[model samples]
Target: MDIEAEKARKFRISDFDLIRLLGTGARSSIWEGRDTSTGKSFAIKRTFKQPEDDNRYLDQAINEYEIASRLQHPTIRKVFSLKRVRRVFSIREIHTVMELCLGKTLEEAPPNSLLEKCVVLIEVAKAVHEMNSKGYVHADMKPDNIVVSEKGRVKIIDLGLSCPLGTVKQRIQGTPSYMAPEQLVCWPLDARTDVYNFGATMYWALTGELPPTVVPHQDNSISAHQKSAIPPHIVKPGIPLHLSYLVTDCIKIEPSGRLGGMDAVATRILVIIRELERDQEPTFRIRQRHGTGHGGSFLVSEYRSVAVSERLGPERHVIR
Candidate 1:
């Protein structure tokens, strides 16, 4: 590292070097740092002092470490080490060290990058599937928790709300918009919950708009439960119908109705990639430009979607 970079790396707060502030939440702040002894870059998540809130945040940190430690997927951030420190002022602090993932969150992704978004989502889905197969649920799955690296790889982070399938019902956790309907009602959850959240995440990526908070009972208005049926072309015209349908199926309200699982989602995405590879020509029609008075025509190829699977399989159930 250069002298400036070295100086940047040396800045500290309460003995730990603050390489960079990764993100902040209601209870903690995450920072990028390096272990001086080993010279390895790691992500350090620090929780603030609030005795009453300490146990909650501490439990979350431990859960994150436990879940991540058991997972060895390319799309999941890896935890290297964890530690706790108590200051002379009587404040307890907890820190978790994870492999440094240099990238931006999907929330910060550019709107015009549809193909990029599709590719990233598929990778994340694969990772979530692997986690699910192991009986773990990433209770908090959202754009903010998905990291996009400079090399274009996606890694899911912040497993604070995650828990093994059977234990999640004891805690009502996860973000509002990304939370499944069952989660909102405090019902026991499973891998399908993550599938629903991932589907919503993809919807946000395709439309550049968040899923509607008010779920309409009828087809006249958009409902989160009906998200899997909304075509990308309906929001922004000209996207391939096949792609639009793919996204629609992923967001189905009934977990059983959604694409079979993450592996199924990945398989469908791969089919699209194969078709694109076979024919480099653009297959979908592009919308025409109205006039100078109106905005230029947006590229329809910029968005994608998924279709629902017709076949049925053994339902994966959680004991909770």
Candidate 2:
């Protein structure tokens, strides 16, 4: 008898009461589970072996647990444990327990304003920086992987593609629209890779559009020839020019051209937010009686625009 198999046989799916199906992936499903012994709730991810996948899905499931469990950050969801089930001599299924994050993904409900989005991305940048400092790269980062709560808390989820810093993958892996150019080929991935993905994510969050990447989106016909992304302000008028420039810099094709690291990215965004808020205030509304009748006149004061282009200075890298 295999020692590991004997140990795993003691734990089974019946140990937890699966309350509801949270979500599903290619060959996996996430469930809201309650531990029968302790009555504690958790998010349980289960992946099953399949003939066509050839253990790819199982590898990812194990990778996700290994990488995520090592990371410790408030904005990053916590992964608790990994369980394997064997049928005789071979493992058949894997389950990972994680913090049951309650919120809608950024894809389902994005922040309503550029300010809100910037704030959310700032938290995300910090979380990724934490991952980098811990010697890991979050290879997959997109709107769908970030969950934002009603009270404005941000939590980064999904680490299946994550790897040790400077790891050269055996094959291309990442979401197409948000993938960095280096990710298209089997290149040595580092913090810069995450920078590109974060920038692409930010570009989409601010402009409601995807940035140009190596793997072109079905709707992005010009992506192949496009050298750089259009400034966010160009795609969306109200986005501050400074904010737009920062996002574009992040998605630069070459790793050296993008923001140096996640820390720099987070600090720069924080500065941008501070400048925007300090220089401008929310639009104010006023009402006055026009003809002294039931019908009254009301007018909303135009939103004041911040001169961020000038305030940001000639050198974009300077945070101050």
Candidate 3:
């Protein structure tokens, strides 16, 4: 037997308990698993093919491992290990183990107040900024790809289709709803592509709607030129106008028109966060000390109706 075949034969299935199927992607099927040795939970990914099938997804699975190995960020999911050699009915397969973020995705989770959403959004923007800094674009970013931990930790997961910032793939690869105009045209991609996706993601989160984009797979009539996305401000008048503008800037049809890069987006959003924090610092602090909740439990003084306002944040949940 070859080295891989020998290794596969030696590895035992008892080492890990595959709990259940998590989800299926273009390259692999993800399973919720627990290591028998450490009793630790993980999301296990493997080629989604029967034993007799050829090695089509195996290479993509390996590529995902290579590309993901470089990432190390607080908000990005960690790939703990890779099992490149596995056996199922004498057929060699591949497996990748990733940290299992504890909480549900943004959509599945209970409704988060706008402030909570803003807090989540900034962290995701920071993660995207880091990826861009390292010369990679998280070519695939949607709400489902983002999971919040029980303790409120945000994690960006799934790197199956991520590519180098400027790479021109053989074909388009991205969720149709989130793809930027450049992706539709197969143009050289960069951080701005992620900006557009992030903007569209924000639009959906705020209005419970998917923003318009150039999706060639669906139809040619709604190309970026033929249609314009309805700005979030109009869709939901309650969202702060400034916040809506921030998202709109990211989804500009022209890359040059985007808000510079993800780093800049992060910085701009940080400013907004600081402003919100400052705005609430005065009377709200006294209320917390005097025993009052965030609702209408005002202190019955000059600032009686001083309730904490609902705020907005960011996140991406995959839809397909």
Candidate 4:
């Protein structure tokens, strides 16, 4: 270990109290921590240095910190600090402090309504599009890596597999159900790769089923670049045709055939979100106020149009 980076600090694990283990990776384990001074919750990822023959786990952790530090978006999880710790003379570990996105992973907490699906996908698309603009492809995009907070904030949580655009992944790094065809074959990655992943993620969010990965068809005429997609509308009969079309087009096996760019994909999804918002019928709220409408004093119940989709007290509800 350098003991000193060009700019950053070296600290010990004793600085924070570990609350619970969040998750584990090949070379790193994330723990929910509480800062000693601030007492605020944070997710700390402790990455153990791996030997050369073992995957570059330390480097990947640094890469995640670098990539996450550069991109700043509400839906994109943030890394607050990075520290290096030396447990022994020759052993070093990297600790990444991040915002504690409290909630169940999207894989664990499936969305219940179409509106919820639309809201989640729109935020994810915006964040991914931003990363694409900066030339990074989140090689892994899946429900397991997304946290839908108890307060309803959707955050993209992991970046271990993230790599720069135009970079060809040497190994398969993404989940099978959401992996783009090019990624599996080690093709150069770009914005379209994110589009495919986003499409697959949204497909699962809308329908309870996952998209079939691209595979070589039995006949020689069909190439491995062809994917067998079951439209969301097909699985979930209530899925709108427009959304069904959007999800199918997003997962096109070939890069050229899929939505050309994630920015465009995001825009198209935004349009759908707006349309969905408009389709929601306005709801009225009844407010009680003291007034004298007649000769006698009485309480007046006034009805005013409040809004739709937002929660209303304990009787929280969202339109499907």
- Per-residue lDDT tens digits for candidate 4, residues 1-320, read 33223113332366798776655666667777889998998888888864563536777888899999998877889998887666666446788999888666778766555655676776677778788888899878888888766555679998877889999877766788898878777778988988888888888888878898765334423264454687888898988899999988888877888888776776676667667656764442223222321223232232222232321111222211
Tell me the lDDT of model 1 at 76: 90
Q: Each candidate's lDDT (Cα)?
A: 0.65, 0.75, 0.68, 0.72
> By summed lDDT, which 10 consecutive residues of candidate 1 come out lowest?
311-320
Superposed by TM-score, candidate 2 places the C-alpha of residue 228 at a distance from the truth, in angstroms, of: 1.4
Candidate 1 Cα outliers beyond 4 Å, as residue runs:
1-16, 52-54, 86-91, 214-229, 279-320
Clashing pairs in 4: none
In candidate 2, which residue pairs get closer than 3 Å at backbone N, Cα or C atoms, i.e. clash? none
Of candidates 3 and 1, the better by lDDT = 3
For residue 26, give model 4's deviation from the true position in Å.
3.6
| Each model's Cα RMSD | 9.9, 10.9, 9.6, 11.3
Residue 270 of model 1, lDDT score: 62
Q: Write the per-residue lDDT of candidate 1 for residues 1-320, one digit (tens) a residue.
A: 23344345443544345566765667677677867766666778776556565477777887889889998987799997777776786547677778777656778654233544565676677788888889888877889888755544568888888887745465557777777655655566777778778877777777766654434344333344444435676987866677778777766666666776677776676666545534543333223212211123222222223332322122211001
Order by lDDT, highest first: 2, 4, 3, 1
- Model 1 gets an lDDT of 0.65
lDDT at 252 for candidate 3?
A: 84
> TM-score for all predictions?
0.74, 0.80, 0.75, 0.78
Model 3 lDDT tens row, 9-43? 33334478877665555545666788998998888
- Evaluated at residue 316, the lDDT of candidate 2 is 22
Instruction: Return the top candidate by lDDT.
Output: 2
